[model samples]
Target chain A: MSAPAASLDAVRPPVRTIGRDGRRRLLAAGLVAPLAAFLLFAFAAPIIWILGYGVADNELASVWPRVSAELRDGGDELPPDEAVFAALAADLRGSQASRTAATAARRLNYALPGGRSLVTQTARALADRQEPDPGGGWRETLIALDPAWGERETWVALRQASGPVSAFFLLSAADLRLGADGLERAPPEQRIYLAVLWRTFAVAATVTAAAIVLGFPVAYFLANGPPALASVAMVLVLLPLWTSLLVRTGAWVVLLQDQGLVNGALMALGLTSEPVRLLFNRTGLTIAMVHISLPYLILPLYATMTTIRPELVKAARSLGASPAVAFWRVYLPQTLPGLAAGALLVFILSLGYYITPALVGGAGDQLVSYFIAFYTTETFNWGMAGALAILLVAATAILYVFYARLAGPRGLSLG
Target chain B: MTARRTMRAVSAALAGALLAAPALAQDSVTVVSWGGAYQDAQREVFFRPFEEETGIRVNEETWEGGIGAIRARLASGGDPGWDVVQVEAADILLGCEEGLFEPIDWDRLGGEDSVIPGAAQECGVGAILFNEGIAYDRDALPEGPTGWADFFDTERFPGKRALRMHPAVALMGALMADGVPKEEVTAVLATPEGEERAFAKLETIRDDLIFWRAGAQPPQLLASGEVVMTTVYNGRIDAANREEGRNFAFVWDGSVGSFDYWVILAGTPRIEQAYAFLEYIHRPEVQARLPDAIAYGVVHREAADDIDPERLPDVPSAPENLAVSVTQDLEFWLENAERLTERLQSWAGQ
Candidate 1:
């Protein structure tokens, strides 16, 4: 074999002399350049921007950098000197005139609720002033304007909020907070995010499992059946994919409601006496999510299954192996790559599922994405939203790594 | 290939020029509001008329209620999209204090006293009065729900109840259902025991409750019989009855009346145009046209006379309806919304 290859290579044209290899490599790179740049800007940039919010604490730092620096140098304990106060007064005065006092006030309010008015009122009072006198009665003036300025907690909150990076959002995401003594578990009332995270994972996992169980059989049938029948089946499987997820979810809502088609049929057939509460609960969420995710699982599985030859299973069966044993050992092993790919795809997609769950699922069935949406669109807490999103992405990445390790490199491909 | 490339370039430039064409003309003001009939009414009563009176075009946009979009826009630094926004009272208060909105010149748009009492704020002019009230499908539940108490009384009006998935109105409903007087709802919500009492009252009907976040959901829920009764915006229920031929009746007792205000974004070039639109809507005649168009109440007190007397009962600010309704305390919501929402979410998830 080596001698024949060598002889063949010796007879081949000297394409290397024309710089063909470099030109081919250059062409490949050039072809992918647009895609790579697109991915960088559209995908990686947004992820970096969102992840950056986890540590990017600038709302207060931008306005009162001097006060923040002083607070950081003086430690967590509130400083008694008028330097911090003077810095705050000067920042407030500048911010007020520039119309950015509200942003600073809002930032402070996040740290200490109602801190907004205190800052805004003080800023308005001092809007006419240009400078903060170090020796002057600025402290008394500030204290008189808002008694909160005299408090130590207020100072601590201000210092904590004014930072280049803080674990406030990340810790809050984990239902932990940075207390006086450092990181501690949030109070029971505040410990909601952890449960939401767990619920999100649980819902995603259940949907993935359901997709696998329901999709595998259909994919197998499509792969092994007669070509004409298989083509028709494939079209049926892809039909749901053609419809919008919202429209499909809405269809499910109509089909599963109390007086809807499903219940109406069930009653007509004498299957049950009463209409089951099926639309806004865990059952409804699982059904809708599994339906939405089935195509993701089926396409990949079908792709892998089609590659498996019938002769392999026949060969095993002819060797006196039982049909189930032969199929499991020969056919199932071949489809492992597809199964892993499909499961992971379904899992990842389901993890970020929002619309179907929001529309069909009850309040208890809501996932972390719901809260992320609430914070992002309803409360405008980008820090909290970013933190939750980062947690979700990290969780998905970790899951992918774990799946990759289990499936090996070849199994990672979606056929 | 070169010819095609040049063609592409020429077309791109032409498209760009076409896009920038509007920039040279009279400036257009972007007005954001809750979409559907409400926006339609505003377009008919305010936007078109304002545009006709002044050559400044009014660009209409729709937003589901929240200050988050405005905050996101502002956070990105420059221009916050819409010039004039329709905001809830609590959001307006918060946005005004934070300077997200430009302070209204009450003098220009009829003095503070000229608008309905409590409708005028430092940065917002009250546009319309909307109510969150019990709405029941008359055909579904013949013995319809009368108020929050009847809503909570499942034995009397037994069905799945849809409530707004928020702390403010939900808590108030719970308190009223628990027999707390309308005036004392906020005072009771202020105390820990009051909060606990409200939650406990809510707990009784927790299993039968289906929560809706958007204003559009409640009427749909009622019409589909998915929920026999639900807390819905007064105008939405009215629209459903009028348009869909659904016999949905609103229960005014224990209804929470909240005002939607027209707020000007802080740093928009069309601030003058936004103020002009706001002033135009503040006119009694323009305010009166709103009720006939959408069945929502006008904030201008004198506009009541201009409204059809036969349609008065349907308006949220109607004398009979207003008598039984509790005005939502925007201040209380502004201060406690965060804490209460967190608690509400935790409870809801459980």
Candidate 2:
């Protein structure tokens, strides 16, 4: 028989090791280079930079460079000395001229309550004066200008804010603060974010659990039932994919309002006498969020369940196991990975929900995302928002790793 | 079709004039404001009249862009394209401090005394005044409330009521309901006792209060009877009644009002034209026409007298409404809003 050239090349066994094959390795790297660069800059870098704002304290540094630089070397316990005071006076004059005094004042105000008056009032008084003496007069003159200027807390906040970066936002996000000794829980009256975060986690977990319970049986039907009916039901399940979130949310608002169709139907059936409280509460939020999140859980689970063969359960049933025993022992165990994955996906996605909760939830039902939005839009406090978002993303990333390990071969396949 | 054709011709003509005779063309400055009915009202009264009175062409633009837009322009260091902008009160205060707006030429634009209180500013003049007040469906709560005090009295007008989610208005409404004088609302809120009192008042009916964030939610809530009354922007109620024939009315007593100011961007080359346009717009006759078209009141103090008596109770800036209204303290809120909101949030969650 005449062997072709391809057959002879396939039989050759003299190939070098992959490590020694520099050209192949280089070609492989070149193929991946564009994607690697894109992710590094587009995805990874921005995330890292934003997360850095949690600990990065740079308000005073940006607006009052001289004072920030001076305070970097000074003791936190002591009030800013005459030299630091002179730097501050000079910086305030400079900041006022440059129109940045408000930015610094606003930032300091977050740290020391109502501290805006301290910086702005001082700036106004200092703006009207002649140039500072750059001597001992700054400490006294500044205090004379505003008695609050003499307070230790103002100096401490100034020193704290004078940063390359610090843990101020991160600590504040946890409702903890850097006290005299170190980090301490904020007073009971002011403590908020920890509760908000707990509420956020609890809501996400509840939504995840509910989605699984509702979605699993449907997923099994789609996996095992007649093809045409399964496909149609799958289409119904996925109808939300094309609809906008606001539209879906608005649909719930229509269906679940006090005088809406849901109540009307129930009343007509004589199921209830009065209108039910469905909107603007936890019940409304869960119903809407679960409806929106169900597709994410169902599709992944259906995909995983379809791959499992039916013969194992049949074999177990024929031998000795009852139907329930066969399903529990043989079928359910096989589906655990899919269930965990679906639950995780729903949980992480639910954590980022903002608008649905805002529209459907009462004030008490609002999650961490609400506080992030409040900080961003209402207060324009980017540091606080960044801290909250960092915490949220951190929680999501950890769960994602566990998911990746469970769905190892098809780790990135969403469906 | 004819209107579109005319607009196309006007835009073409304006473009050609810019390219062909850039120097010789009449001075035209871009004025940006919050668009829609407000801009339409302005076009009829201010822009059209100013263009007719002076040979200078008027270029009108509109934006809801906040102070950051101005900051972007400043950073770019070019001709600030928008010569005169209608800015929110907070932006005016912040921008004026930053010297982003030109000092108002009080003499050229008539005396500063000509404008209403809070309308006259260091760098800008108030363009319009709008109010947020307690509103109810006349069909639902026909008795009508005397003041904010009646709003909190669930025993009296007892039904679910909504307030804007933010602490600012709700706290003010609570304090006013609890018998703090409307004029003293801001002063009382300055002290810890005032904040404590406001929250305590809120706590009495805390479980009963429903909070809404969107401006549109209030009217819907009222129409559905989910809420009997709500803290609504007066314009929403006015528009709802006019558009949907839903008879809603504002309890104008003890309302919260704020201003939108017309400010000249600092270092504008068309300073002359800007001041002229501003002066023209603020004329009592011109200012008087705005209230008829929209619910907002005029900025000129004398303009209040010119507004038709029929529209008095409907407008937020009317002297009758203005008398009982409280202007939010920009300086005080800037200092305390964050902490107080945090306090309110912790309280709400509990």
Candidate 3:
């Protein structure tokens, strides 16, 4: 160690002598540090916080700690002792007197339907009477107030709801639930999230595919055409992006309605006797989404396609290769990086679409983001919303990893 | 070293100024309600008058109906910004029980007997009475729908229908269409068989149904001929007819009436000012002026006595209209909304 240190000291610069490269590196990092810190706090912190809601169990635990503790200790079976009932009585009376019974009731309702009324009613009934007679009558009184108290499912739900963290929300997001035995598929009628997730992906994939097919020709023309025409075409491509998404979707609604311009033109030409059902369906959703997402696909492809020299194709042709073979082997493979970037961007954006589908699409056409908004805004189910959001983020990340694997190292650069 | 210190001092002052701006502006009471024509009417009839009379600046904001925004604001463990919020009956009950709202003293505004029956609650005061009813474009459906049953008779009506997406009013309408009596609707809905029966009845018109989420969409749907008939907020149809000259006819039979109430958030610092504004809006004369401005029914019974006889029929709380219309069972909805909404969403997806 002493020999190596002596050699390093011999080669090192004198003390307090700073080099140009070292100074530049320090300045660059100093300039970027604020932005990095801002992103960590502003972007990453909120995401991590929201993701934490999926595993939060404070609502039930905070309001009815005694009952929750008893339930947790009782395990899977219904507690045979009357002490559980006394604890529940005390908790309910406490919550009712404080007017916080609804919080605990709402938490339990997530597990058992109608548990809100069962809890609130029992609390109100007990609130009217004295402290349970300190006897076996407490159980009978609770059952008499709400017969649901006697049900095993109620006890099961109570036990499940008492948690520091549980897999209930994550399982619910996948349309599964924890039963007495183990995790099982949710009832067929309640199996909605899986189907909704599939539809979200299906709609996003269709939009991405349509955007690519329609955008490629336009982007190619702009890339290869004269400068003036290219500028005009570029402006035309970007004009819709400048407009509000609501306005663009509204324009589609106006044009695709039964009595709208398209239908009027169709009937005027005697194409059909009746107006077609064009709006408020999957067809309307795809058309509108493609129009909205086309610019994303076009810009990236245009950037890449314009960089491909015309002489490359000419050189291939000079080697006696047919035009089709040369174009297929040389041109298409060169554009894969841009294609990957554009497809990933459009697909990720489409997966979180909320407004366009809610306005233009039919009831069944609504996506998972719509459900996220529903749970967050309408029902105030933050846990469910967080779980669904995590699923979406994870899904997008997985897709990105796959794209990266397919596109190789150069794929990171969108251009 | 001096330059760096100065830079730090300036940035600190700027941050402190940013933080102090909102604190200095806290004298005004923020009022939140449904936007569009509804908020416009409140601004004209309630907010402007209250500000003029009380000298307290009123900051008006708009929100679409739901307690989610309120819950979000309160979740941050600080003042929830708004002093008063307009909420529906079910939400008022739920929010009150959850301790999200302050218990209102009805005697301060008027005695308990002064407010309309079923409108007074422990933590909220009824602001308006509204109904959800079938409406049709006069030019398109001249015969018009007579009742909910006619709404379901696609064979005779022979056109698409727009219904609200939620289960509360829609399920009640479905049960009514299936010939269940008004008083028995809640009882019937309590059973699984009743729910199945309602869904089965709705299935007959599934192909013809276009579900709408917002109150404003129904009139637009009817105007654009997207649907021949829709269940719309009675006030929206009235406003469209009066303002746009759209000849839309309302079917009052089988209509379901409910109330929207004003409640103060539990942790608001402006409780006295909030109560004053609430008191001001509930004045008999102020309530009377509201019908002409927004076309919604008022909860002050005496306010109805002040309206012109010609305009009284448009009010949902008119004695004749109330006789035919069913009052919404708020307790039932508050208890069952979570489960029923999930079921409704699943059904819509199917």
Worst 10 residues of 1 chain B by lDDT: B1-10
Clash count in backbone of candidate 1: 0
lDDT of 3 by residue, B35-141 (tens): 98789988987887666556567998888877666777888867888889999786998888877889998889887788777788899999899999999999987
- Predicted candidate 2 versus true structure: per-residue lDDT over A189-307, tens digit per residue: 78999888888888998999899999999999999989999999999998899999999998998899989999999999999999889999899999999999999899888988999
lDDT of 1 at B95: 81
Q: Each candidate: RMSD to true structure?
A: 9.1, 5.3, 10.3
- In the range B168-199, model 2's lDDT, one tens digit per residue, is 78889889989888888999988889988999
Whole-model alpha-carbon lDDT for candidate 1: 0.82
lDDT of 2 at B342: 86
DockQ of each: 0.32, 0.64, 0.47
DockQ-based class of model 3 = acceptable
Q: Candidate 1: where is the Cα deviation over 4 Å?
A: A4-18, A79-81, A121-152, B1-37, B48-91, B98-102, B264-277
The digit string of per-residue lDDT tens for model 1 on B43-122 reads: 88788766655556889899887776788888776787779998878688778765789998888977898876668889
True contacts kept of each: 0.40, 0.75, 0.70
Q: TM-score rank, highest first?
A: 2, 3, 1
Evaluation by lDDT, superior candidate among 1 and 3: 3
Poorest 10 consecutive residues of model 3 chain A by lDDT? A128-137
Off by over 4 Å in 2: A1-42, A131-136, A179-182, A398-415, B1-25
